[model samples]
Target: MNKSTFNTASAIALAAAALAGPAVAQQATAVEEVIVTAQRSSQNLQQVPLAVTGYSGAFLERSKIEDFNDLRTRTPSLTFEQFAPGQPRYTIRGIGGGGGVAVFVDDVYMGQPSMSSVEFVDLERVEVLRGPQGTLFGRNATGGAIAFFTEKPGSDYRVKAKATVGNYDLKSVSALISGPVSDVLSAKISVIAREHSGYAFNETTGRDIEDETLAAARAALRFRPNDDWDIQLNIDGSTRRGTAPWWDLMIEAPKSAGKSNPEPRRGRNHTDDGYADIDNAGVSLNANWDSPIGTFTSITAFRNTQSHNRANTTGLLVAPLSDVANRRVNFHTLFIQQADQKAEQFSQELRLAADLGDRFKWIGGLYYYQDDGVANRLTDYRFYGFGPTPVDGRYAYASTNETKAFAAFMSGTFALTEQLKLQAGIRWSHDEKDHTTVASGKNFSGFRDGGVSVPGYSAASSADWSAWTPTASINYQVTPDVFVYGTISRGFKSGGFSDGDSEKQSILRPFNPEFVWNYETGARTEWFDRRLRVNATAFYMDYTDLQVSVFTQLAPNLPAVLVSGNAGKAKIKGFELEWNAVPIEGLNLYGNYTRTESEISALISGANNLAGKKIPRAPENKFFMGASLARDFGGMTATGRVDYTYQSDYFSSINNVPSERVLAQENWDAGLTMGPAGGAWSVEVWGKNLANELHVVSISDILGDAFANYAPPRTYGVTLSYRH
Candidate 1:
């Protein structure tokens, strides 16, 4: 950690200790309780018998967690990476990427990576479950699951609105209104708009880059005709327009010949200012019927997304040799890439829950899902020279993939005694996929020569896979304030063909499915009359046929292409410690620490045997600490909060090249709010990354050059909110 970060963290720690010293001597209060649905049923978080994290909507708003990247700083063993604004990738316990982790919104699966950065408008809570959850969640739950629950319409009327202004010309406004339309109907609506100026500058274009504008809206309706039947419907849509993420050229290519420096800067020399545009919309319907025997629930959902992006892949402005002296040219571009993607998915689920007796309870569910996606990409390389004419080479690639999946799952809990319980669950899943690809390239002898078409290829393939995943756990209540559990579970992820590869072999053969066996033990305890709560978990996972993506050349003269294949075996083990304390009334302290170790145990044949390499994006250690205090003075209330987070260094690729390593980082955030006691209006001032730390979040190495994406710099904002 740097000097500024160390000092900021130390100050917060000292302040927390100082407050606790005197507060501990006073009368303590019970910590707040959190309810979650990790097991497909509502239960207290401390009694869930799983490694999970829950965040209330109020807490998220106070912390200013606007997106998934902000949430990763507070959660343990969670890693988030984004090459651009709309495309995001998440990892948990060294397992992620390409269907390894499942994301859900109101019990509806989000199948596309572009949908990962949805707006957190009006939410009841967010839950992050670690380890395997395949038995209950069905397919693509190998790493774990993230579920987001939105607040439902209530009988009473409510209105909430918020506005924020920040540095970098940031502006945001959001509002939500919910009320009862009649005795049997309720409705709710929420909308948000946010915009910000660019953070980076384009030296060549003389314009700002990395700016963003977003707008989203959601509507919901609930109907209750009788005491036993209930129905709800939700619709949401969002649009995002932004410049491409800023990438620092950390290392120059060997062919550059001293034209660029190998240092990180906030300026780029791209000829064109790239752009990203994304549109996403979804709808869901849910119905429930209560009967004497059990409760039956049905959920049907559909989603569609489209995105178009253009970027200067090389991050360089190359001039033709003939115009080197003038330092100016008509076409001063080196390389450019453009991508257009479209995806749509539909899912249906039916579930039943019942209690046979006081000693046993069970739940069963059936699920079906289908999705289709298409991606078209273009790559232009100006190898020989720069001009207004045709370039030296141009490549176009397109792919379409379709998937269908079905699953049935059931789980039961039998209380052997008052203090001991046995839980078991199983799921049978079947998946089918069809993929097609078309690739072609055009080559030119020079800027003035005629173009020649290279050999093109088109191929199609289909594959199917099936898996039976199971889970078993034993739980014992040592006392009313303490609980312990041990569990074993299995997870599976289906396989598919690679895209952007023109080779016939790549399309003819599809990758195999990956599987994991996870073993875990955990404990939850409270002390000092429920004033302090602690939770700890230890887990180990064994993986077989692990799917991995690597960049390789199909031939000596062709450009590199990404290919997906199965690896031999791998292992990952990790432990987490989390604690929350309410030493005295109006004072709260919370923190978590995590340690992870991941390694490849074996490699496929003909490989150079990189068996012990660390998994990509898996940091060794992660720590978070925070304190919040609220005080009332006469007719007004004031709350102050401070938090710190730390993450160890990690590599961005399986190769673990030193140049591609993301360095360790430390961050600090603080916020203060003031309002009238029990009033309808309030104001808050918040700052993130107070230490102004510069750290890389992702890196890509191509052609001996390393490009890095850095986290956002220091930002401060003020918000005004009204509730009635």
Candidate 2:
């Protein structure tokens, strides 16, 4: 995926992406202002000092964002993939993990992969923080964070209801009601139900690849006995049932390419329909105390999640097992996987802040977190049939994993001068995990009558890691509306054992924890009477044993295991530029661009040289822009906006080979909304992938069964919303 330096292809792609984002003329009006708290304090989007992106309730409706996972393509610079398929696999600037991404629900961490099941329905806003977040927050935040703010109790008594219907026979209902329980207390409750027929049909089986339904609810109470003290408690839960298919539809090449050659030129098409269910519940308490010395805050949270899913890969209609050529006789056409997991986490934090003197002010905090979890998976493989007959052999793997973790952290800030400030922080964290695998006792294809005889493997292993990380930052105000800053920080991620000898050990590595040191500089500025603002940052990071995940061929019915290792010298440097301006009444414009350079200086034996190449999932260039106009007529308001995002070609695998074949696609989404202020609500229509262009995303390079995943197709929908 590395742009070929000194080559015409790289130059052309860069030029095209440079102009990818829209360049709009300033305008006026925003769709119900977006609010965010990237700095740990509630504030309007425009007032946040960091690079932040907030989507208001109104915007979410227009974008057809139904669940928490739908936020992927709706936002620029955001991309997600399920390494484990139904999990929250978040990647911002390609910064998440193979284990999944970090999710923050109302400032509390999800803690583990399965815990990401937190639903996004009845939410007030979603904020995406786009870089290392060391100044605030907790957990493995090296890649920044995604915050989902559920509906909260307001100062006024209110009742709101919303509903929508769309294709796939999709229908939804959401409502929120809040009012005073007494003079000193208030409560709010919100709920949502989503039902859809799913987007899958079996041409031969007379079945759909997908069918799913879900419902979720939340209740919260706020007690403000006085201005100096307040308490808030929230309880939420959700349940889902049916198959949520993983549709990575591929366009197979003409039969001429030959089934023997599963290459880019000769394609083999295969996909799967799977089922999943999830039940989740959580409770949180937030209490604040205002003292003359400073402000004291206490937060305690507990959550539990149970999830299950079943799916098959590389399964297609029964076909010839022989006459397949080099790859024909040994490959598998149908394989199934089932996973069940339970996760729970509890956390508490106590902090104090105050303005000590004119030259010095500080904030300090004590934090604690614990995680306990278990995950079990079973996989079964069916090989090229002996003319459509099912056989029994040695092929099935079942594995279980147990995990635990704990951490403590604290930090403070000091104003060195009227125009200068400095901050420092440190954290100590520990994690432990154990894994075991047993033979599923299922027969294989060649051994018995049914799929038979793969010997079950019984093995167990455990690993633990501890690390101390420190962070420092300095900021200087250069002008009334301009500031410059620099930061030096460290990031750590623990590794697990991967004993290729066993199924349970094959998927994960028992390697030591990886650490990274980062140095950064950035600037924030505003000019033209606050009519325009810009923010940008760049950084260089050094890695020692930076852990990475790569696919490794395993046993029959079992997909390639995800391997971990300390890949040598790697570096990532990127810069982001965003501009916001309003040149005149009724006109608003925004544009942003991100350019990243990534390289792997070395590779393990038998692995291709990825040195000087763009890291997998790291796009060399990304751009976004939007312009909207607002007009008021007879007390009603109308608005229109168009946004575009362009990404340069990227590699989907670890190999840096030139002919792997990934595409560069530019997508645009536009919307229109009209409504009266404080009235019923608004009506909107929106479209994504407006050009209806085809794009290639990830591709498997395993030699015998290669395939490519495509991006979403052109989709358009209409929405209507009410305020109360």
Q: Please count the clashing residue pairs in each candidate, in the order shown.
A: 0, 40
Error of 2 at 684 (Å): 1.6
Residue 714, candidate 2: C-alpha displacement in angstroms = 3.4
In order, candidate lDDTs are 0.81, 0.62
Per-residue accuracy of model 2 over 1-724 as CA lDDT, tens digit each = 1112112222322232222222222234322345676655556554444556787765565455655434664444566655333465566665666432467887677876666765555677888876555446646666667888876685776665555565666555666667788988999877766666644454434565455576677889999999998889999887777663433324333331224322221123234456677778899998889888888888899998888887654333434445446564443345566778777888887777777777665566767776666666665655543445544333444555565666666666678788788877777777777866554455342222122333445667777878887888888888877888887877776666552333333443366666667677778777777777777777776666655666654455333544566667677777777777777777777777877777877756224454665557677787777777777778677778787767777766566544344667787878887777435666777776789666554555432454443444565666655544
For model 2, what is the C-alpha lDDT against the true structure?
Answer: 0.62
What's the true lDDT of residue 558 in model 1?
Answer: 30
**Once superposed on the true structure, which residue ranges of model 2 sit more than 4 Å away at CA?**
1-36, 39-70, 74-77, 83-85, 117-119, 242-272, 319-332, 385-402, 439-454, 497-509, 554-560, 605-613, 656-662, 693-699, 708-712
Query: What's the TM for model 2?
Result: 0.83
Tens digit per residue, CA lDDT, model 1, 562-648: 667877799999899999999889898999999999998886422346588888888999999999888888878888999999999
Q: Which ten residues in a row have the lowest lDDT in candidate 1?
A: 18-27
- Best by TM-score, which number? 1
Which 10 consecutive positions of candidate 2 have the poorest summed lDDT? 1-10
